[model samples]
Target: MSRLKLALFALIFLAACRTVPPPAQPHSGFTAEQQAVLRQIGFQPKGDQWEFGIADRFLFATDESRLMAAQKDSLAHTATALVNVGIVSARVEGHTDNTGTARHNEKLSLERAAAVADALAQGGMQRNRLIVRGLGFRFPVESNATPEGRRENRRVVIIVTPEAVA
Candidate 1:
């Protein structure tokens, strides 16, 4: 009986001596500020990406890499939002319609992407955080046969990942 009691006491003591780990912190998808910025910028979550349609004023003219004043202002807001959300990295994809030659389209796309990257950098986003890709006439969201579709295809897409968020 004494041996049994000793064994029980030993087990109890060992259990008591075991260390308890700290509780894990709760994780929300995004910060309030980030959410607010997303809302302000009118971006909707689409699958794994956030999609933002460039307003008419921000739309790039054909074969042009220059940004309008309003476009710059809009990009500045986007940059501020990205900074607020603690995005560590992002890909800026530039796409062009099939109107021009493939080589011309590719060059134009690259130039447009670079222009956006420059604008974002000017808006205070770290240049290192931005990756520029020019898709040319590839990866069209709509059929390039129609004018409207071509217009929709000529766009810049900013891709962000969950791992990118701090």
Candidate 2:
């Protein structure tokens, strides 16, 4: 009886001694420092991509692709951050509200993207690593029916590709 009791106790001890696996790390390609820097500068993580953006009103006047002086400064700082972190590839995309013909919007959005890409290049990011696109009303973040929604739709998005931080 004593031997049986001791055996049962040993079995229970073994069952209770399970080693829990370590906590799972986030599935992100960026290092902790890079993530911190991006988050601090208003970039948000979407899966493996990091995105930063602002509405068109803040950066451009009505139908104008030229970025304001202050907006240029802001984007330069953002580009500097990317260069500092050794980001290898980034895409600068422009979007516009559906307030005009698709052809017009497409041209305007492309100009906007080019303007932003130029700013980043001026701030020391390699020109070759920058990809520019003009989505034009085709990928609105909000409805075009309301003024507020239209404003939201007129924006630029910068996405750091997975190739970044290499």
Candidate 3:
């Protein structure tokens, strides 16, 4: 009886010590429609945000904030897609290479972000739904020591949040 009681106690203790996985978090950010839109616009998912690289139709000229004709068309398509997906708001973050002074980079980044935001607005997205930010050379995805990396660093990231979709 004593041996049986000890075995039962051990079994109970082992069962109590068994690990249980935590509840799964509900999916956030991009909805199905939004994801479709992102795909259509050629935006790649980078973690929580979406990136439109220079390889896509969203390239910016060297040290320039003006959108090229192709870039404008891309923005238009993106705007239409965003509307279709019911995504009412987005945060546009502009980044640049570390070649320029911090102040200059900041200003240039802001200009680039504003240019993109304006293009989106013209494409039919409401101005109120867009928030522009210039991060300058603060967040570089690659080392700025290489030309390719520098080019990659000069980019605009569109961040979609649950609140934006909601």
Tell me, by lDDT, which candidate is best. 2
Candidate 1 vs candidate 3, lDDT winner: 3
TM-score winner between candidates 2 and 3? 2
- What lDDT score belongs to each candidate, Candidate 1 first? 0.74, 0.80, 0.78
**Which number leads on TM-score?**
2
Model 2 residue runs over 4 Å out of place are 1-24, 53-59, 164-166
Residue 8's lDDT within candidate 3 is 100
Q: Candidate 2's residue-wise lDDT over 69-121, tens digit each?
A: 88888878888987788775688888888988999999999889888888888
Estimated TM-score for each candidate: 0.72, 0.79, 0.76
Give the Å shift of residue 94 in candidate 3: 0.7
* lDDT score for residue 26 of model 2: 74
lDDT of prediction 1: 0.74
Task: Give the lowest summed-lDDT range of ten residues in model 2.
Answer: 53-62
TM-score of 1: 0.72
User: What's the CA RMSD of model 3 in angstroms?
Assistant: 4.0
Between candidates 2 and 3, the lDDT winner:
2
Higher-ranked by lDDT: 1 or 2: 2
